[model samples]
Target: MKLYPIKSGNFKLDGGAMFGVVPKSLWQKTNPADTNNMIDIAARCLLIEDGNKLILIDTGMGNKQSDKFFGYYYLWGNDSIDKSLEQYGFHRDDITDVFMTHLHFDHCGGSIQWNKNRTGYEPAFKNAHFWSNQDHWKWATQPNNREKASFLKENILPMEESGQLKFTDLPQTDMLKNSPLGFDIFFANGHTDKQMIPMIHYKGKTICFMADLLPTAGHLPLPFVMGYDTRPLLTLDEKEKFLKLAADNNYYLFLEHDAHNEIITVKQTDKGVRLNHVFTCNEIFN
Candidate 1:
């Protein structure tokens, strides 16, 4: 199996929102903010190539929105999904599965695109089966007031309308496991309802896809949780359990939202699970 980091692009978000109640003095040291107090965020998705199956973990926010709509995020950089795929000698059509961690626009927005005539939306990955769990599907479709803005209909509804949507067949019990893509999935409900985190076993090491569960190495501190979490207190408990296990097992956490850090190993420090070493995929996987 081969893994590639598909960098769609970078955007700026309010540092305060990203780090929640954490003081600027603390988080700004690791994730320095610009003059506008916006921090750089990378929509770093993962691509898995095993035999004939090419699975994508997430699609960064697509380019279908209006210029004014995109202006809100203050997007930067030229890196795009097609360019990233081409870098690895692959194409969007080659993807057999699009595994969404959640339905947030930044994660799943690239799942759909405007049709040729601009009449309606269509699945961006024509040949890929979009993976989302039943609980998340309902949560996103029938979104609460707080998360409605992130659940854009254009980014979601087209997958089901195109008949390419597939829900994971795992029970709703606490922390279920499933390996539909040959990688075990660890489910968490704190960030959103039933968000799946992939635990991949390859080359005698375990690499976990850190989708919002741990956005960046800076977020390792137990108190540093995102304000967007539906259940902030529950998120603290989830992070505590996961960080302990991650540190003990010496697992590599593949960061999704961090612009600089890609993969990191954590160690149990006096303060708790702290960043140990960072790696580019080429240095470690290649």
Candidate 2:
């Protein structure tokens, strides 16, 4: 199996919102906000190339939203899903699975696109099956007011409409399972209900796709959780448990949103789980 980091695009988010409860004095040191106090964020997705299956982990925000709508996030960058896929000599049609971590616009917006003639929406990956959890599907479709803004209907619905939608077939008793794509995933509910984090066994090392569960190295500390999370206390509990597992097992965390630090490993320091070493996929894969 081969894994590739896909740069979908970049956008800005309020540093304060990204680092909830954490003081700007602390977060700014790492994030270094702009004049508007927004921090840089990447919609970096992952491409898993296994026999007969090309799995895309996320799609990033597509270019379908109005300029006025996008102005809020301050989208910036030349990188795009098409360009990123072409780098590997592949295209959207080659993707057999589009496994969304969640329904957040930045994470899954590229799942659908405006159809030809711009009449209506259609699945962006025409040949791939979109994977989401039953609980997350419901939560996203019937979104709460707080999260409704994040779950844009255009980014969703079309997957089901295209008849290419599927859900993880894990039993209720299991926290992790062997995915059809030949990797293991454990679900976390703190960041949003049933956010699945992949634990990939790559070349004798475990590589985990750290979704919003751990956005960046700045979020390695227990208390620096995102304000967008439905349950911050649950996030703290989940982070403690997951960070322990990550540190003890020496997992290579493939960060999804971190722009500067791509991959990071944590060590059990006196201050609890802290960022140990930073490496890119180039270093590890080489």
Candidate 3:
């Protein structure tokens, strides 16, 4: 199996929102904010090439949204899914599975795109099967008021409408030992209901796709949960448990939203789990 870090795009978000109640004085040390209090973020997806299947985990926000809609996020950079895929001599059409960690626009938006005439939205990967779980499918489709904005209909629905949507069975417990995608999945609820964090065994190491569960290295602290999380307390528990496993097992965390830090590993420190080392995608994936 081969894994590649796919740089879909970059954008800036309010540092305060990204770090929740954590004081700017603290988070700023690791994730320095710009003059506008916006911190850099990356829609870093992952591509898995194993035998006949080429699975893509998450698609950054597509270019279908209106300028006014995108202006809010303050996007930056020219890195796109197409360009990133081409780097590996592949294309979006080569993706056999688009396994979303969640349905948030930044995570799954690129799964759909405007059709040729721009008449309506359609599945962006014509030959791929879009993967989501039943619980998250419902949570995203019938979103609550707080999360509805992040779960844009244009970014979703089209996969199902195109008859290419497939659901991963919800695990009997929080962690699914084996998934149809051929990886262990840890289901996290603090960020959003049933956000599946893929635990991929790669190159003799476990490379965990740390979705919103741990957005950035700055979020390693227990209380540094994102303000967007619906259940912050639940997040604290989940983080504590997961961080312990990560530290103990020496898992390589593949951060999806950390623009600066591509990958990291944590150590069981006196204070608790803390960042042990940082690695560029090239250093690890290459």
Candidate 4:
């Protein structure tokens, strides 16, 4: 199996919102904010090539949203899914599966795009089967008030409408071994309802796709949960359990939202699981 890092795009978000309740004095040290108090965030998706199957995890926020809507996020950077795919001699059409960790706009927005005539929306990857769990599909489609803004209809419905949407089998336990996507899925609810974190086995190493469960290295601390989480207390428990497992197993965490740190390893520090080493995608994948 071969792996590639697909940088969908970059944008800025309020540091306070990203770190949630964590004092700026603490988080700013790892994720420094700019003059506007916004921190850089990357929509770093992962691509796995195994045999004839090319699966993409997350699509980043697509370019379909209006300028006014995007203005709020302060979008930046030239890196795009197309460019990144081309770097690996591939294209969106080559993708067989688009495994979404969740239906949050930034993660699956790029799954759908405006049609040629701009008359309506359509699946962006014509040949890919968009993947989401049944629980998350229901949660995102019928979003609560707090998460309504993040779950945009335009970014979601098209996949189902296109008849290319598929659901992974939910495991009875927190972790699902040997999923349909050819990897294990660890489910977490604190960030959102049934957020699926992919655990991929490649090159004799276990690479975990850290969606929002652990957005950045700075969030290694158990209490550093995102304000967007529906259940912060649950997040604390989930993060603690996962971090302990990550440290004990020596797993390589593939961070999706951190613009600065790509892949990180954690160690059991006195303070708890702390960042052990940082590696770029090239260092680990290439």
Candidate 5:
């Protein structure tokens, strides 16, 4: 199996919102912010190429939103989803599965796109089965007030409307059995319900796709939870458990939103699991 890092695009978000309860003096050291306190983040996705299946982990924010909507996030960067796929000599039609970590616009928006006429939306990956959990689907479709803005309907609904949507059963351990993808799904509820983090076993190394649960290496600390998380207390609990496992087992965390750092490993320091080392994906893959 081969894995490729697919960079969708880059966008700026309020650093304070990204790192809840964490002081600017602390987070700004790593993810420096602008005068407006917005920090640039990459909407990085992962692609898995197995024998017959080509699975894409997440779709970054697509270019379908109106200019007014995009004005807020300030999406900038030359690396697009198409360009990233072409780097690996593939196209959208080549994907067989689109496993969404959640239904947030930045995570699943690129799964759908505007039609030629701009009258309706269509599935971006025509040949891929878009995978989302049933509970997450319901929660996103009927979003609460706090998260309603992030769950855009244009980025969703089209998957099911196109008959390419498939819901994975909760606690997806059995779903990954004997799968050539060489990954186990770790479900956590802190950052939106049923966010699936793919724990991949490659060449005797375990690399986990740290979705919003651990957006960047700067978020390694226990209290660096996001304000967007519906349940911050649950996030603290989940992070403690996951960080312990990651440190003990020497798992390389593949950060999804970190622009500069691709992967990092943690060690059990006196201050708890702190970052031990940082490396690029290509370096480790090589």
Candidate 6:
């Protein structure tokens, strides 16, 4: 199996919102903010090439939104989903599966794109089966007031409309019974309802897709939960447990939002599980 880091792009978000109760003095040290207190974050996606299947995890924010909508996030950087796929000698049509961690715009927006006429939306990965769980699918489709903005219809409805949407029958257990991608899935409800974190076993190493569970190495601390999380207390418990498991097993966490760090290892310190080392994805994959 081969893994490729598909960088969709970078965007700025309010630092305070990213790091909930954490003070600016603490988070700013690592993710320094701009003049408006917005921190630059990477919408890093992962591509898995195993045998006949090429599965993509997350798509990042697509370029379909209006200028007025994008004015708020300030998307930047030259890296795009198409460009990153080309870098690996592939195209959107080459993808076989799109495993969405959640339905947030930044994660699933690139899954759908404007058609040729720019009149309607179409699946970005024409050949890929968009994978999401039943619980998450329902939560995103019928979003609550707090999370309604993140779950955009343009990014989601097209999948089902195109007859390419499928849901894995994931149980409510902490550990997945059977993953659609043949990887173990860990579910967390802190960030959003039933956010699936894929844990792949390859080359005697475990690589975990740290969705919003650990957005960055700076979020290693249990208290550094994002303000966007609906259940902050649940997040704290999930992070604490997951960190211990990662530290004890010496797993490599593949960060989705950390612009600088692609993968990180954790160690159980006196305080708690803290970042032990950071490395690029190639360094770990190779």
**TM-score of every candidate relative to the true structure:** 0.98, 0.98, 0.99, 0.99, 0.96, 0.98
**lDDT of model 3 at residue 33?**
96
C-alpha lDDT of all candidate models, in order: 0.90, 0.91, 0.95, 0.95, 0.89, 0.94
User: CA shift at 220, candidate 6, in angstroms?
Assistant: 0.8
Off by over 4 Å in 1: none
- Superposition TM-score, candidate 1 onto the true structure: 0.98
Residues 72-149 of candidate 1 have per-residue lDDT tens digits of: 899999999999999999999999999999999999999999999999999999999999988899999999999999
Question: Alpha carbon lDDT of residue 258, candidate 2?
Answer: 91
Q: Give one digit per residue, the lDDT tens place, for model 5 in 34-123.
A: 999999899999998888999999999988998998899988779998999999999999999999999999999999999999999999
- What is the lDDT for 202 in model 2? 87
> Candidate 3's residue-wise lDDT over 1-286, tens digit each?
9999999999999999998999999999999999999999999999999999999999999899999989999999899999999999998889999999999999998999999999999888999999999999999999999999999988888888899999999988799987998999999999999999999998889999999999999999999999999999999999999999999999999999999899999999899999999998788877
Per-residue C-alpha lDDT of model 2 across residues 50-107, encoded as one tens digit per residue: 8899999999999999999899999887999999999989999999999998999999
* Number of clashing pairs per prediction, in order: 0, 0, 0, 0, 0, 0
Q: How accurate is candidate 6 locally (lDDT)?
A: 0.94
Q: Ten consecutive residues with minimal summed lDDT in candidate 4?
A: 221-230
Residue 237 lDDT, candidate 3, scale 0-100: 98
User: Candidate 4 lDDT, tens digit per residue, 58-116?
Assistant: 99999998999899999998999999999999989999999999999999999999999
Give stretches of model 4 more than 4 Å off.
none
Model 5 TM-score relative to the real fold: 0.96
Instruction: Name the lDDT value of residue 218 in candidate 2.
Output: 95
Candidate 5 error regions (>4 Å): 172-182
